[model samples]
Structure formats: C-alpha cells, structure tokens
Target: MLQRGVRAMRVLRASSVGLTRPAASRSLAPNAARFSSSRSRFPAPLVASPLLQRAGLFAAAAASTSAACAFCSSSNVAMSPVAEAAVAEKAAGQQPTVVLYQYEPCPYCCKVKAVLDYLNIPYEVVEVNPLTKKETQAFTSYRKVPVCRIDDEVVVDSSAIISRLRELVVAPTTASNEDEAALAEEEQWRQWVDQKLIILTPPNIYRSVPEALQAFDYCLTEGKFTPMERRLSKYAGAVVMYLIAKRSKKKYGIEDERQSLYSALDSWVAAVGDDRAFLGGAEPNMADLSVFGVLRAMHGLDTYEDMMRETAIEPWFSRMTAKVGSSSRTASN
Candidate 1:
C-alpha cells in the first residue's frame, strides 16, 4: 500500500511538471456542490487481489525509474505499505468528507469549490467564521480559508487542492493524440489565472451584506477586537487590496490586463463552445475543471454579473451549469 501511494505521488509530481497524459478535450460542471451529496459514505476499499498488487509494484518501479532519469539522480524509491493502509483506513467508514477551513465570502475558497462541483466530487464543507471559531484558528494558524482536508492529506491553497482532487478522482474521459502539445498551453492559462487574474483583483467587489456581517460576527467571536475595530480592520484590508489592485493595474496597464483576461475567457469559451458541452471534447477534463474553478470567482461577484451577461461568457456559464446540473449550485448568503 505504501509503495503504491508513493508511486502515485511520484506520478502526480511528474504530471505537475508536464509529464503525464495529454490535455483532454471535455467540459465539466462549474461547482463542487455537484458532487457534495454523491460521495460514498466510506472510502472505496482497496482491492487486495494479487494482480492488483503486482500492477502497483510495476507502476512504482517505473515511476521511480522515470523520476531518477528525469533528474539524473540515483533511484532512491521507498515504499510503505503501512502508511498507505493508514491513509486508506483514515478515509474508510467516514462520510465522503471534504473539510474546508474557510471564512465566509472568500472568493478563493468559492473558486476551489467551483471546480469540485464541476467534477462532481462530494465533500463536506465546514464554514470557519475565523472571528468566532477557535477550532478554525487552530486548524489554520494563518487564518486562511479554503484549507481543505481530503482524508489524511491537508491541502492548503486552491491550486494544491485542485491538483490533489484530479489525482484521486478518475476523469470520465481520455485525452487525444494532440494532448501533449496542448498541456503547456493549458498550464500557461492556469498560471495566468493564479498569478495575474486572482492576485490583481480588488476585494471590495465581494463586500456584500452577508460578507460584512460574517466579518463582524467573526470579530465578536474572536474577542480580540471591538466591533468598530473589526470594521476598521476589514475596511483597512479592503483599502490595501484596492491599492494592490491599483498598482497592479498601473504596472501591467489596466487596459492590457483586461484585454488579456477577456481574451483568455473568450478562448476558453470557444474551446468548450456549444459543440460538446465541455471544455474537454466530450466529458469534463482537467482543463475544464481548472477553468471552471477560476471562472466561478469571476462570475460570482454581482459587479461582474452585467459584464458577464453582456458578453459571450454568460452562455458558456449556462452551458456548463446545465451539463453539470443544478445540484452543484450553492445558496448565496
């Protein structure tokens, strides 16, 4: 079990560096809510068949050799059947759980969930109103939301969670012969969303009544600040965010960034288009999942609703939701 887990991890790492399957052509749903209710109550039991064991061993050996060759390092592959069993055990008999340490109104957390829904991955959500929950404080010392636990693995940040999910859940479709050539292209787009689109966005856009109330509630629970102090802190955070967005816009040229973002969105929409109903050719694929994750944030804000509605993006969003179905939709507070 340990050897197999290590092998899986190695394969995942390689894929992260552009080593695995080709870019698949498919469209996926737009939210994790699609899968939230369908996950098995327990982790699927590991098959103990001898044939499976042999296959696992072969896979581990091949992955280790590939890693060694790629990095020109001596093969130092290690396996731990015990550790693998532990992880499997941890997931066993539990609800299909996905515990998220997230504050209310966090766009990033919402983005992560959107991908999960699109992939129809079931998860248990734990809302961490940081100001009030001591457990939340303990879970993430840094007080970041969207910190997710899949069984024994603690996934910090949206990208990491997305990557982890892709590994554990098998996609419904396969990549075509031209997938390799497209992997880099898709990766480049994903990086742009993370570094430029998300990092450069203003936060005030999400300061709805629910979000403000949640912040106030959190402050009251933490008891570290008075109501006024909490308000001031949130306001200050917004100011800082605005300044950061302003600087980014100025440096990158707001028009240029906007154009780039729009172009990316347009390209993504076209890629999925009306033809097959998903970004990947027939079924949802990694590209569709990743794109949906980021786009969810872009579309969620009320400020962007009109912009989205006025553009080609709206239809694309509609098509994605239709394919994934309404079960994935979350109640907006």
Candidate 2:
C-alpha cells in the first residue's frame, strides 16, 4: 500500500559531530524531582517497547548513534553470541528479536530505525539517557545511544548495525552478494554520510542563540533532568551548543555555513542521479538511511526546511518517508 509522508527524523548514536552535550558527570542538585539522582531510566515509563530505555526524566522510544560508521572507528569489541544467532536466524528465514538501545532526536539511531522499519524488521526499543546510559551498561562497554542488542549479540555504530543487518536479510544470498566492488561503493557513500553530511548539521541547527535554545527546549523535555537541571540544561545547554556550532563551522571549512549545508544536499541528490528512487535503487540502502537519519535530527528547524526547499532531495525524501512510514503503519495495524 502506498502512503503519504507523516512526521519523523534521525542522527547520533551523539556523534562527535553534533552539539557537544553536557558532561555525563555533572551532579544533580539536592531535593530534585521524584526521580532520585541514582534512579534508573526504566521503560515501564510507557515507551514503545519493553526494552526501550531513556536517560533522565521521560523514557523515549528513539535512540541515537555516532554519525560515523563503525568502519570509521577502531572497536575491538567482539560480536555477541546473541547477535550471531539472530543473524543466523534471519538468514534461515526466521525473525530475530531486536532490542534497540537508544535516545530520541539522535540521527544515527534514526538511521537504524529507518532501516529496520523500512525492512519491516520487528524489534523492541530501549531508551537510555544520553547523559548517563544506566539502562544498558551490562550489555556494552561503549555505552552509546542506538546500541542494538540483536538477541544476545550487541551491535554499535549505525553503519555497523546496518551492514550487519544486511548480512542477514538485505544482501542477496546469490551471486549478487559476491559483488565486492558494489559493496565497496555502497560503503563509500555511507562514509560520506558520517564525515561529510553529519558535520553540516551542528552549525546549521545551532547557528544562532535562538536556534540553539529552540533545539534544546525540545531536548530538555525529552531529556532526563530535575526541574532545576532542566533549566540549566536548557539555557546553558543552548549557549554551549551555539558556541560549539561556530567552531564546527570553521573546522569543516564552511565559509557560508548554510550554503555549505545546501550544497552538500545538492551533491547527495546528484549522486543518487535521476534513474533511481534512492541511492540504493528501488529501496533505501545504508547510504540513503544515513543521509535521511542525520537530517531527521534537525526536522523542525530552519536547516531542514531550507535544505528541503533549496535542494532536489524532496522527491527522494518523500518517497522514502512515504514508503517506510506506510509499511510501519501497516505493520502496526
């Protein structure tokens, strides 16, 4: 069934790229909300899944990952037996139980979510606080958002998660899987998402004081914090991001920051070219999801709107949004 676009966006499983978040070590004030400083961000708190974890005040269904792919990092972590089993099951035509550990408004998490939802893969969510990831410490040493425990196996990094997931269900079992060149090409684009595209977001979204506050205001509500902490995290957080965004603009060599962002979008659509519905052809590939996921984090802001209006990304974006969203809604029904 075909469907029109609904609302949603993605990034960060907290990329080194997005606004610098508050220190996870900051202590809460005395006499806070019903939430003790030592309390856990439990899911019973009414989230999308039994496994969903959120840090701080409210438990959210969304999760985040670093904007960079797993390949971009050097992680010595071993694959979990549970993840291995899940992959085996998926390859064998069985559904694997996926537990996604994440926080909302994270682009990388959104990327994984989009892929999972687009593939119609069934999974549960665990929302861990971005500041303090108390919910899933037992599962991972890295302790980041968008950490997915596929059965017993734990996968970190959006690119790794997507690549690993494709190993089971996405890539064809036939000769097509043997195309190393095609796989390499796909990987190149995924890298572009992390190194190039995600870098544009921080400067664009937190470009001004007003924009910074607006972004944080929404985050504070979704964030885990006492009333006092909420105020601190809101105002102070906005100011910090506003400053950091400027530095980021300079680091990425974005002279007219907004234009740099717009140009990147244009380049992305051009890479997709005219014949394909997505970079992956008929459906979203890892590249498509990464691009969409990162941008999703800035959905309600000027950056998202300007990019949508100023670039050729809309048709493809709409196609992906409608297709994935329709499938998800249908599955829910």
RMSD of each: 15.6, 14.7
Query: For residues 118-138, could you state the per-residue lDDT of candidate 1 as single tens digits?
Result: 665555555543323344445
Off by over 4 Å in 2: 1-82, 138-141, 176-184, 223-233, 326-333
Report the lDDT tens digits of candidate 2 across residue range 81-115: 45454555566544556677665556677777776
Looking at candidate 2, the ten consecutive residues that score lowest on lDDT are 1-10
Best by TM-score: 2
C-alpha-based local distance difference test score of model 1: 0.43
lDDT for model 2, please.
0.55
- TM-score of each prediction: 0.56, 0.68
Give me the candidate number with maximum lDDT. Answer: 2
lDDT minimum window of 10 residues, candidate 1: 67-76
Badly placed stretches (over 4 Å) of model 1 are 1-95, 129-135, 171-176, 179-185, 203-234, 256-261, 298-302, 327-333
